[model samples]
Target chain A: MSINKDTIVAIFLLLFCGIMINSSFDIEDPGYQGMKASFWPTIVLCLLSVMSLVMLIKSMVSTTDNNLNSENTNSQNIFLKFKNASICFLMFILFLAFLDYLGMLIGGVLFVFGLLTLLGGFEIKKIINHSIISIITIGIMWSIFTFGLKVILPEGEILRIW
Target chain B: MIDVILQAFASIVLDPVTLGLMFVGTLAGILAGAIPGFTIAMGVILTLPFTFGMTAIQGLATMLGVFVGGFSGGLMSCMLTGIPGTPSSVATTFDGFPLVRSGRPGLALGLGLWSSFFGGMISAVILVALAPQLAFLGLEFGPWDYFSLIIFALTITVSLSGGNITKGLIAGLLGLFAATVGEDEINGVARFTFGFDDFKQGFAFLPVLIGLFAFSQLLTDVEDDKRAKSPLMSQSGTVVKVEHRQAILIILKRWVNLFRSSFIGIFTGILPAAGGSISNILAYDQAKKASPNRSNFGKGEYDGVIAPEAANNATAGGALIMMMALGIPGDIVTAVMLGALMIHNIIPGPTFIQDEPLLAYGVFIAFFVAHFFMVGLQAFSLRIFLLVTKIPMYVLASVILAYCAIGVFALHNIVFDIWVMFFFGVIGYFMKKLGFPLAPMILGVVLGKLAELNLARATGISDDMLLFISRPWSLFFLLMAVISVIFPFYQEAKKETLFAKLYVPVSMIVLSLPLFLMGSPVRMIVAVILVLTGAYFLYKRTSSLKIT
Candidate 1:
């Protein structure tokens, strides 16, 4: 039997809440008026646990209505869609990594150019124009926040000199 | 008060920088709001980091401009493309598109803008008068009362959860748990940090917000772009010149619907979690019920456009009342705005009004000024907004992703927050696909800490958890929460087990036993309510079962 998305969510949340509750044990309880540092998390996790269990039961009981969960249509379609979107997602991850090392201004410009290139039908001319626009836009954004507003942005190891 | 208001108004108007920022915010709001997939909350959030440099008045005025302009701008798409620019504009499309198709797009747009302006003005007037009174009432709330009030506020989730009570509850609970990740407010001990220094300070509110709403939407837009080509409007440059005089006369004739819808908007806006999405639909429903030309509502009736547009815009004003007076946000946009205020180290509470009267008055005046700007701009710049709507999804997504990254980075100059945003973005996207509502979860995060802090304080003060129900207001809110949770199910299932019918009320009554043992009148009243409701449910359930 294939696990429906709801069942998966429930199981994941159950495990998450379990971990959360267990971790609460590590904190020193204040024990004042039977309330402590762990009190609220305990209450929240307890409610979450109950609700997650209910969701699991409901998902299990209504397996016939699995079609109601739209994401469960077909594994292949889901994968293809995820794969298509993964290009952008990958660009996002790369952008974050770039921002970490290359600084906000340079990293932002590169991130925009790369994402636009992937999105721009792969025509060199279109990619070049999109990159130009992306650079101008990112430049303006960087100037406004970094220079105009005096907000700090990452300068990268190499770019920190200038 | 009058002098302060005058000074605030003068300061905003005379200062070109502040005025220009407000203008920019309004223009950006109109463009963003006209986009089919963008929400006003996203507009406000995208504008938040921009405000970090300005003073409280300048920043807030700019945000308010966006708030008003965004609400007004949704009708552009609704009229031009049959797409509701924001969730609040969903009802606008019902009659608005038909009007566009009927060749009076100009009239529909004109009516919607005027309606929104009037709605905004009316709510502002009411806010100016009512907020102080509410603030006074807010000052009376103790920890227990505040906790109860939050319970009552959270009942709004029942109405908002898109008919998935269990999922909504789960989402809200998860949010509360997420809020507990940082150091404990009472003991300074970390509960859920899992040994990470980044987790110790907990997830910053802005990062979580940006992730949930803006970044998640970006990812979803990307997915949608991959799945199907987005349908673009046919005539991207078409402009229909509205006969303003005729439209104003038509609006003037429907004064009753205007005022009534605006009032409904304000009332719903005051209810936490029930924002424009609820108010606009309600206003439209009430207009349908009250209008002489009910048949024309969905057939391109001008009153139909007016009802929702007016109501939705009015909600901005109504929501501000709760935010300013009580320190609690009534909806997502206000919630973000609350975060904005908090970022400036201005804590909102009963004393918020007193402590920051000048700024408070400045916000009120700003709302009024924003309406004026929105009206003036939309009148001459409809084509500009139309062009903005035609921006390609991928281009917008890429820009939004970059903004999300850069904006979060600018918040604390920390890279960890970016990761936090990315993580929640994935969660939010999947949650949307799974039909779990995001608003409840957001409300949970925003209110969870407030609820827990107050509940813990109340626990400390009273030395008994059950003593929360000993107060009259506390008991009332708890009882309301119980009813709110059950009422949806009761409506869904007309026939249920008799045992099930008695479960919640019986448990609540039993739970109130400590108060009863303490011989408090509050418990007696609560017990009576539970008994009556329980008996009624039992009677209905048994009769329905027998009939079936």
Candidate 2:
């Protein structure tokens, strides 16, 4: 028997609520206060758990409607969509990692260049075009934020030599 | 007061620095709004940190430029490619695209621009006049009343969540939960920090907002297989020459629609969470009902273009009114603006008007200047608008990703917020995939602190939980919340006879089980209501099913 995606989501949220409730207990209460630090979180966790249970049951019961189930399954290539989003997500994680060591200017340029190549592929002309645009964008952004705005961005130890 | 207003206006107009910044800001806003997949809200969020370095009026002046320009810029893509640049301009595509297809692209573009300007002017006038009165009302609200007002605001989720109350409520509750992660405002004790030092300051709403909206959108764009489609500029179409004066006069002749739609835009804008999306659709509906050439509407009637365009642009003024007068944001953009203002140490609301009347009035004057600048800028920059659509998706996506990273980093020179943004981006993506709406979640984040603070204040005063319902204003709001939540269910039930049948017995069992276990009076009352309504619906459904 195939488990419905809706049921899977409901189960995931149910588990998240369980964790949230457990975490809520660790929140130190303000002694005899009107509402404790954990008060709203606990209420929300209870509501969320109840809602997740209903959602799970609803998905289970609605499985008899083959039309709805088929419609949900046949909407798009979920695997392909997940793959593409995962690539971008990985690229973003890389960008975040780069920002600390490379500084905003260098890290931003590398991220833009890398992402453009990832999306458009490694055509020489396009890569060159992407590189030029990335440089120009980073140069302007660095100057504006660093000099014009006087907001200090992370200049990393390596880039501090410059 | 008049002298102060004049002085504020003079300071803005005479100072070349402010004037130039406003022009640049408007141009940027137009570019931001004109780009497909970029929203005015996103534009406002991206622009917030830049305003940190500028004066209050100057920063606000620049943002106003973005606000006005973004609304007007959406018309470009709608006419040219039949794709709305922003959601607010979705209706503009129906008639504007048809007009473009008929080779009167110039007329559609011209009429839309002029309508936007006039609609913006009308809303600005009303905002100037009505906001002071509304602010006076806001000033009278005590803690109990303020809590009630917030409840009314939260119910906006019912209208916005695309007819899914349970999902909307869950999203809202999730947002409220996220808001509690930081130090407790009352006790200074951290909640839900999960032992991370970074979580102590909590997730900054700005970074979180950019993540949910801009970053998540970028992620979705990347997931599209055909993300590298040919630029819109490659399409060849004739733009018939339009007489600007003649077109303006023709749009002006529909004075009833202009005023009516603008009023709808303003009123809807003032309502918390009801932004241009609702206003445009409502205005279009009203115009269709009143139009003599109603049948011609969807078939390229100019009135169709005028109504939604006018209404949506007018929403800018209407939204600003709430932000300026009551200190409550009517929508996401204003919420961001409130954040920016707080960053500059300028508090909005009734006290804003009383203390910084000149600055408050300066903001009003800034809108007028921004609209005027929008007209001049949009008129001569038609070629640039055409070029904006031609930007490649990958390049755009990459630039935005970098911008998001840089913008969040610039906020406090911290990278933790960027990580928080990334975390929320993943959550937002999954939520969207699961058919949950993000608007309610964002609204929850914006209003959560307010709601918590006010509820605490009110509860402290009353010393009884039941006092919330005993207060007349609070009771009224709770009643409104009930109606807002149940009315949609009621409407859905009326449509689905089978659902009404199944829902009743199921809800009765569900409610009764909890009531039996808990033995709470409130649970019993709720269960009783469910049984009665469920029984009535079940009976009606059975009768209908039998007849069938």
Query: Interface RMSD (Å), each candidate?
Result: 1.9, 1.7
lDDT of 2 at B72: 86
What fraction of the genuine interface contacts, i.e. the true contacts, does candidate 2 reproduce? 0.65
The best candidate in terms of lDDT = 1
Over A13-48, each residue of candidate 2 has an lDDT whose tens digit, in order, gives 899999989988888875865767677668768977
lDDT per residue (tens digit) for residues A50-158 in model 1: 9999988888877564553476577777776675367767887887877757888888888888887776567878787778878998898888888878878888865
TM-score of chain A of 1: 0.85
Top-scoring candidate (TM-score) = 1
Model 2: DockQ vs. true structure? 0.57
- What C-alpha lDDT does candidate 1 achieve relative to the native structure? 0.81
Give one digit per residue, the lDDT tens place, for model 2 in B1-548. 89998989987898999999999889888877777778888788788878878998998899989998999888887787777888888888888899878877778887888899999999989988988877886786667767767766777664555745777777877887788788978778888788888888977888888888778877877667576544534552333454478669889899999999999999888887788878888888998999999888877888998999999989999999988887888888888888888777776766688788888888899999999899888754556766666677767777878888877888888999889889998999888877778887887777777778887787677678775665545555565565556646655676556655665455554444434433557657876887777677667667767553
Residue B443 shift from truth in candidate 1, angstroms: 1.3
- The residue-by-residue lDDT of candidate 1 on B1-548, one tens digit each, is 78888888887888899899999999888877877778888999999988888898888999998889999888888788787888888899999889889988788888998999999999999999999889997886789979887766666664555667888888887777778888877777776777788888988888898998888887777675442234344445468887677778999999999999999999888877788888899999999998888899899988899999999999998999999899888988899888888889998888887898888998998899999899888965687876664567777777778888888888898999999998888788888878788888887888888898898888878777666677655776676677667766665663356646656656555445434544557657866776677667556556666553
User: In model 2, how large is the Cα lDDT of residue A16?
Assistant: 92
For model 1, how many clashes? 0
